[model samples]
Target chain A: MITSLSVQWRMDEFCELAGLPAECLIEIVEQGILDPGGQAPEEWLFDAAALAIAKRAARLQRDLEIDWPGIALALSLLDELEQLRAENAMLKRRLGRFLQE
Target chain B: MLEPQGSSMDFKDYYAILGVPDSADDKAIKTAYRKLARKYHPDVSREAGAEEKFKEVAEAYEVLGNAEKRAEYDEVRRYGRAGAGFEVPPGWQRSGSFGDYAGHPGRDFSDFFEAIFGSAGRAGEAPGRGREGGRRGQDVEMELPIFLEDTLADESKKILYQVPQYDSAGRRLADIDKTLNVKIPPGVGDRERIRLKGQGAPGIGGAPNGDLYLVIRLVPHPLFDVEGHNLIITVPLAPWEAALGTKVTLPTLKGKVNLTIPANSQTGQRLRIKGRGLVSKLGTTGDLYALLKVVMPSRNDEATQQLWKQLAEQAGFDPRTEWSKRP
Candidate 1:
């Protein structure tokens, strides 16, 4: 049965979990760095995954002294590399399974 | 003979005080003295009551300084107290007894010196029995720098290092080839230490080896900087693309993705790509953010200039009207 108490989050709740101030969150939203929703800020919502990403972004800026533009480029490149690696691994696994068959 | 007022003078073993054997050569004696002198030096020491210590070291150097006095003192010590029981030696005056020797002011000797030499105020006495196997190896340290990407990728990096190795004869040799495969963990920041266990010198008598530590350093990326897992990309958009909403193809880590730019989008606008960031050990992904920059055409042809003039007259829209009203 689907329970009503299933974990869900709104944009504000996710920002709070990420330990970001409302002003910063607003700036990120206005800049389009984060999409809370397709509509206005009031209607925007985010889940736990978004909140975790936000927290990591905050730490990178605060602790690592990385600027926003640099942070974006780094994240994109690393994501690309990781995706390639994952795909390669998945293919290898599939090939091995086929061989067993 | 009239006895002196003070107590009898005690003998001192100067060779033992300098950490040298009785049969030590001149070179060994000088080396030992230099070491002790540095330890008890006044200028650099912060040890408690070190001023008194300096004076004691000075006094030890004085008697050991003169060869004639050292020889006589050594003879008196070797004879033992029983040898001096009845007859005073030739050239030695009985007029000045051991009690008279105490009348001279005591040097600022430490209790360590006093334990060996306070009773025997004279130098060159062989104090205690000899101790064996006395030498120890020196400790060493080094620093290393590593790339930030290498650390984040958890790659095994081989580092060439030179460490001091001792031969079986205990001679220190240089340029030891110690190749270390450092396993870098993801998220390792600059100046973090990766300790290589049991990689240092083999201790005496097969004791556990010392540790070699590698300090991590991240090389700065030309195009990107890592802040946790998120990546930032500054993309230049055409003026028309910014003015009117359009679907633009953007390069992401995975592949090209179609991104929508809202109408009237301003420069410095940012867009986020979800789950498109650095992969972490926790099986979680970060994000990729793109900042928009509007680039205007530097040179316009006569036809383009005429088209803009016509559009301005027809539209009658002033972009700066809001700014003028701000006062």
Candidate 2:
């Protein structure tokens, strides 16, 4: 079937795709690792970004053997580091253009 | 121990995969696996083929990490390289099967793994494979790299991926190739996931088929760098251009436009070009930023160097004045 990223998954579907339990997902949301829409679990709507973040969070938790809080902190720091690195790379590229003969 | 096929594939040495000695203890093996896993984990590393390397490492750990599996593997290895005609030796039964690279998005095990451990008993035979008396299909994931220009319009991308095939009894035969024409939504950024329902592995025993997830990866553009929806292009300028105002042709994703570099503009200064970047899902356009870079001639002749020296003496600019602010 032809599909796009406009797919917004609910709690149950998100759980299955991410291979995570409901409580763990709820805990991740509580830890600020994921911020889905709506007020409650049943009413929650997770967009494409939320699903990707959830999968990444699950991997971090599983492979690194980190707790929810730790995973949250790690995700936050990793996001910051990625942005910083991108900026650095862009600057370096610009510098190379200037320094090049 | 599982009964081997008539002709076996190359045997993967778990010890070699994990980079541990044959006589390495559990602690040593665990340490080695952890070090390699951290180095090669797909999520953590960007090294080419890191995921494949991590898969091998994880599969190795699945056996070596367990005492029973490791012992069984060791005994099997003692029988020499079972190449053409190999047997599992009578009276030994394959107990449990390994996971599909535990905790990975893609539920795929290698042919070597299947031949050695046998496919994870599907159809309620294994501990967790079955759901409601039948096994649910494995989910498939593939990376889809889209060009930076693709974010502007609703484009259709043709993708080819393989879906795992299983028989009625849940023994994996081989993967069947599936081709699809996927329509990508406009403004999908890097790392966005598109889910296609019931397009993964086929279900067995009336179970529901798995969903396929397409992970978006934005291809790097030669002329522009992405910052969210906005694009940044470094504008190269000579020393005279920075001093005196100039109009130069700048390239955007849409087309070429004339950009004005204001007089006395400093290096690294950004000039904003409104509504010249990527289109957003909400039908709004992002602005592009033109970054200024003052480049000098690599090799200066006597006349050029003399002119620069004269300009420096006349300019009387000391950039080091900021150093005096330190208390």
Q: Which candidate ranks first by lDDT, i.e. highest? A: 2
Query: What's the lDDT for candidate 1?
Result: 0.53
User: lDDT values of the candidates?
Assistant: 0.53, 0.77
Q: Candidate 1's residue-wise lDDT over B1-327, tens digit each? A: 112223233345566667677677667766666566556554334478765655655555544554544565566557534223322234553222222233222123433233223333432211111134222222223556655446446577777776555443333345366776766666555544444545655444344444465555556443334456775555677878887878888775556777888888876677888876666657677777776778768799999999888878997888788899986
Give the number of the best model, judged by DockQ.
Answer: 2
In order of appearance, the predictions have TM-scores of 0.39, 0.76
Winning model by TM-score: 2
lDDT of 2 at B113: 57
Candidate 2 wrong stretches, greater than 4 Å: A30-32, A37-40, A56-84, B1-6, B16-35, B81-116, B120-136, B205-208, B296-327
Q: Where does candidate 2 clash, by residue pair? A: none
User: Would candidate 1 be rated incorrect, acceptable, medium or high by CAPRI criteria?
Assistant: incorrect
Predict model 2's lDDT versus the native.
Answer: 0.77
DockQ of each: 0.01, 0.46
